[model samples]
Target: MDAGILFWKAFCENGESELIDLTTIEASMTDSVVATLPVINPSTYTKTISSPVVVIKSEYRRYHHALKASNEAMPINLLYGWGLIGYWGGVMFLGTLWKVGQWFYYLRFNKSKAKDIEKPNQSSQGELALPKSLAMLRHWILLYIVIPATIGTYHQRLFWWSNIPNRLDSLIVFGFWALSIILGFAGYDTFSGNPTVTSLPEQNWEMLSDRTAILSYACLCWLWMFSGRNNIFLWATGFSFQSFNIFHRHIARICTIYAIVHSIGYTVEWIVYYPKYFKSLKENWFIFGIVATIALSIMLGFSSVFLRQRSYEVFLVIHIVLALVVIVALFIHTSYFGTQYNGYLWPTVAIWCFDRFLRLVRLVYCNFSVFSGKAKTTNASVMYSSASDVIRIDLQPTASSLKGRPGQFYYLYQPYTLRGWENHPFTLGAFTNGFEDSSPNTPEIVKKKVTTTTTAQLSDSSDDAVKLKSYRSSSLSNTLTFWIRPYDGWTKRLRNECIKGGGVCYPKILIEGPYGHTQMLHTYDSITMIMGGTGIACAVPYVQDFLGKSKIAISYTSKIKLVWTVRQPEFVEEVCANDLSAAICDQRIEFEFYCSKKNVPTNISTSVHSSDEVTKQIIIQSGRAPVASLIAESGTEAKLSNSRAAVLVCGPAAMADEARAAVHQALKNGCRTLDYFEEAYGW
Candidate 1:
């Protein structure tokens, strides 16, 4: 018989009964006749064992276990941990560096305190907290938003969030490319490994694990910086939350990519080492990680601008709940698994808590007084107009020192009526010192009475004069005005209430912040304010500001124009009766009111601002706004003045887009340099 048949005969007697060493069998079978003979036919072989046969998984487990303990894996993990720290520290240090740069700009104002800053009462503080000229100052500050995003989008293009305009910069782009190249080589250790040691396979797993942690750490840092009150602090340091918002999607996308990679890496590892993936899933740690990934995916999916615009309150609530769920899932996942990333998650949680605490502190400070109660606190008084469908809220404040300027906004919390627990942001339409409405019909009579009363009471005492002056200043400090056009949710509910209650109701309300730093307006030679309907609120305060100050106070601001488009004639009358009336006496302000709707009302006031420039102050135009023509006129005025024109607009998206187009046209039409300011009340 042949050696092959002899070996086949022996295997049939011993099959599945005992482990046969392949090397020993091969060495014995290699004796001449087996090498010379054809391979044995499968019809000739049969199993002799009574038990079922199974694949032994011991080798796969030993492979991964040995690789983990290998010399190469140890050094790879050490280097990974060190590199992760460097990546995290680098981001934090860059953020700090920009903040420090802004602080240095602030320090430059010490010697000669800017006389032409905020108001006389507000101790001037812009320095570089706000841009002097927008483009030069903003781009440098925008670097913090650009770099991390470049790393993700450079390799792969993600739509809308990926390769969008204004989010990338040259300096940050170069830094990102160079850093990525260095990190890529060092992280993989030049792919050096022995095949027998399984270093290559194990190092692949370790690299993926390390990158997941690094990306996660970075995402948390961004979250801590960009969320609510934390974002406010960063804004104060000259890095606005608006800029940080651009990077939010990019960071989130990158982290998601890392998480997917991590999940796949572990899936492969478990299948190779632990035999059954379902068994690994039984561990709470593995399940939690999977849940976190799912939660993140859902949160990111719902975070589009369209969904937010559709229903911000719902989107906000869901976004927040999902974020909390993700954090909790990640916490449980890392803790039970003994993953080192648990420490990073705590800082994120702490920052979120701090943000909530700070918001609470703001609520208390803005709305209530410790000494008194709700009676002394700033309560919102709602005044609505049925014809215009607008709500004029006059907030009576407790803190007189907390006076805001022309361009700022505050959050309104109206729980009893809005049908939501959150606060809504509104632009500061007008700022009243509280004394304006209460001022006596005649200024001369009021002045005479104050002078007479003080003289008679204290015999012309200097102390009484000083007291009177302080009283006059403090009287005007605490009233804030907001003009809201009812839309949906809170505004719609309020509008219905106003409709039922004869267009006015005073509801108990709480105020939160005066958070904005709307740089300089007085520095410009001419200003053209384009107001779409209720956008008059933003323009009116600036007019009042210009009128109150003299040539000595505002040397640059010679000409001011307000182009207002209102749907109803009643809207113009209501605003003019309140805020616009004050600017009528000032010749520098040339305001026009345009009634856009058909069958224009007879009650529209043709109020003349001056005896000289009677036509300039408040000109009435019918139909839609001639935005392009008005811009061209303003550009001509700026050219005549030999100074840059500032076109400040506050309105609907259509109006804003029109203004932006007109601005481009103005720049083209001999306007030396045009600075555009858009006041959008976006929450």
Candidate 2:
């Protein structure tokens, strides 16, 4: 029967298992041998040696779990597991606290003034939708929470040693730190009392196990909250999953290092220095741990930024496969070790499963709808703007209603775009429910349209209201629009398809999300949007949403400014003509257009269009934007008039850096409370 026993018999008879030291390891029938040995690495079977004595298990009943088994401090180690529970709760607590303050600030500053509201339009709509800003939390968090925690976590370690070369060095140092925490492990030494015998070194295995329990718990946030749509992270931070990805990678690095160190400590103690170590090496628990660690290491390597950027498809494929393997291997590993660690592992599994379920539900809801007694996927009409190198797609929603806010991006999937599950994220450009809300589908030289509604009807008539609502609902397209700039892979493929036809292609597409932004722009008393080239996709939705509310004199966003820098004027040439007219007509808004190659438009400062006492015009200029002057202008206006101001920049890295510097300078000069936000694509 027992394989271990058979191995022992075989070894005694023919020396088949030569790896194990059979001479030193006596299969004793006696009580025990109280051997005096050096205390090196301690496990559960171990205790604090009075002087220098190793308690080696001589009696054996169960084959696998028989080696040096001890139930010492089981209750104590279980208590340590609760430390991980505290860590998860702590992060969630902070998120809730910060979100509370953001709500307060947004409600206080941005609201309709009542003076700007036109009497005719005010009664038609039920209420103006002005979502509050959650963006303000970052400013306070960056200074107080992030800065202090970062300093406390790593700064002290800097002074511990010097001459750190790079990030790799930091990872190695952290690994070493993980190893050094196991005290009383100062290399193997000979036992003078029992000169002939050698035993496994004693270490603080209890401490090692306790620390890693907390670490694995910390990692669950990255696995669940960072990627999941319905996570506490989204509610607390009010930012897209894109914004939280970086923090996920950082925490993952720490978690992996702890896991590797955990495996190493066990291997060194039981398999390396212990007498007759080969017997213990044949155990299943030790081998499962090794497999789990290797799988974790492979997953981390493939998920690195380099691999992800070079080829996302390959990274995603291998990443999921390796993650699955790690999960299965850990199930075996922990189940064998005992379920004390399942407090972390089981919850991680549950979170991952729930997230996948939500994703599947979202896909079906977005793509499937009943049309004429049959379920079908919605077809999207794609139109290419040759002048701007941007493709605008108008998607008819399957659902009766479509809703999204600024800064949210959707994962777009086209059947013919590429092969094997290819999806790209693009910002929500602009959308409309009815013709009144519908932006004019204009192409070439932004045009203007002026209409004076002189329909004089009683403001308090329910019949007219019902008629108006019914009429608008019948004509509602519920269109979801997105502007995608042509690039490599999917974009280039779509470009070729468009060029082959008459600048348009109607492809069946699937939509996955209506994600959220960090904060509502209405929170700021004054707001400036700096956009470079195609980065306007991120800003356009906010502009359109605010413009609608601004026309009816909605909420607190009174002073709005947009700074657009293009390589050539033709970049915006094919844009709707009405968009230009509407933007220029709004007195509450100002525009600064900079064209690098095109000369200044003749109407820069000479003439202005006036309709019904509203006068506005575009400020045309040559070359790049004057960042210093623009920022100085913002600061002066905020100090003189507004109590608070915000700058939102979505552009190339260089442009964003410039905007950030200017915003920083304004704050340093003691201007009104100014906050800066940028939308970057580094992920």
Candidate 3:
């Protein structure tokens, strides 16, 4: 008998259902197969039993090493996953500390009486020195030096890469990629004498394929974590959705790279070593993995900045569909492993479900009321301004608990339209408390008549009466306003509808959020806002909040300078006449308007009359706004006054970049206690 068959016979004869002692079986099989086999069948088994024994041992050792390699690879894969979690946890911890410090700072200011408040300069030298120096160091190191700076000659690309993140973000991404590469190749053991894999190169390829596949699975968890609009990371860290968005794109790239490598490694290994390559291509696991990899590549291609900028709605649809395909394909691709690896995948589904649940909660809370008995929904009064090419929407939600704050935004849905499921994010321009019933039954003529009568009353009334009227309207209104620049798609459609309805229409609108972190601008002593066009939506709320807090005697901001740049002087007039009427004549606020139109005169002055019967003269300068000089002047004034200043910029890419560069130079030039905030419009 052959040595291999004889060894099996001895193991079976010992006990088929019980565990055989390898030492006893090997001792019996070696003597029986080696000493007795040659005498019984000398023609076939003439060679010594040493050769068959060695072959059996070599096969057993190869199987042992394969199992050991798989066992060792698992914990390393888990460690890579845990490493990602640890990195984000550290970031959130720092953010939590900053949040707690901010809370205490605000608490101290809130408790102090207005009369007892000390001026910035009156604070003791010792108390100010440490904080001021720390502020300078933080701005110099993190904001100016690390965060905004880019790699190499990518200064101009900053404008193009506005959709991407800055230098610090790149460094973090590179670090993650480097770590993954190291883990993918490291700790893999390959032996030349293995029976399963004849060559060292073949074993190496098989191990590489296995490691990359598992690491890719590990990365999928984070990919989904960063893709949500309702990310806990955002809540914990107080970072913007934009910041996590950059993280999402980079992670997707990394995961896709791993998947590609995994697929290629297996392909090469099968073609070179295994003749069953063509047959394996028909297997369910192989087919689904190829589908997943292709789906991911498609998603990456369509999610480019150029493609997104061209048509966001289309990109959004493609992204959603392909995301589902990739998830499902990946789930099926790894299902052959049963539940061993599915732990990483199910969390992605759970996260997505949780995000959707919160979105539904927000939507229901913001748009519907239990007491209204399902009949009432959020309503919006939309009006189009031809002079400014802007749409003004005053949305009145049924739920009063939904409040607005500076830097918060909402996703608006026009449910009556054909594409009612489509929603767009707009900054919450302003919100007030009493309802204005512009129901569909209300006539446009009646609305015009009421507006004319109010204007007449305001013109004839005394300053106190006008102020009282302004105060009453503002205090008693229950509406949230969103200023929409009439771009393409939904905004353009809204404009057309408003125009068709004689410059105004009442549409059924649904609001889904009050998302985004509120800027703590009131903590600063001086605020300089540089707004361009519809960017004023970001500035108006902060101004209103400051004025409102001051009215309650809790405001920390002493002075606010608003520098607005618009293409049309008419747009400036329109906004100042309405949304900004409260701050127009306020003594603490200063306004500068720049009209960047060829037809507009360089030295034109416009008088904006507030409801308080106060006339504020706003000079509109022609040509582009001197953004750098404005920022420099604000920093210089704040430094001279020994006050903490904040520079807020929200505008076109060119203007924002200019402001960023200006702030960087100011910090570099020893402008202490100055902080910069940017509200980018990129989605």
Separately for all candidates shown, the number of backbone clashes (residues 3 or more apart, or on different chains) is: 2, 15, 5
lDDT of 2 by residue, 448-520 (tens): 2212231121122223222212222233666667767777778778877877766777777888776666456
lDDT of each: 0.59, 0.56, 0.71
Which stretch of 10 consecutive residues in model 2 shows the poorest summed lDDT?
Answer: 450-459
What lDDT tens digits, residue by residue, belong to model 3 across residues 43-86? 23456554233334445555567555545766766786677656
Query: Lowest summed lDDT over 10 consecutive residues: which window, candidate 3?
Result: 439-448
Give one digit per residue, the lDDT tens place, for model 1 in 506-625: 787788777765546755667899988777878877776665543225334677888888786556645554455556555567777777876544223344232233322344567877
Q: Is candidate 1 or candidate 2 better by TM-score?
A: 2
Sort every candidate by lDDT, greatest first.
3, 1, 2
Candidate 3 TM-score versus the reference: 0.84
Better of 2 and 3 by lDDT: 3
Q: Candidate 1 has what TM-score?
A: 0.69
Number of the top lDDT candidate? 3
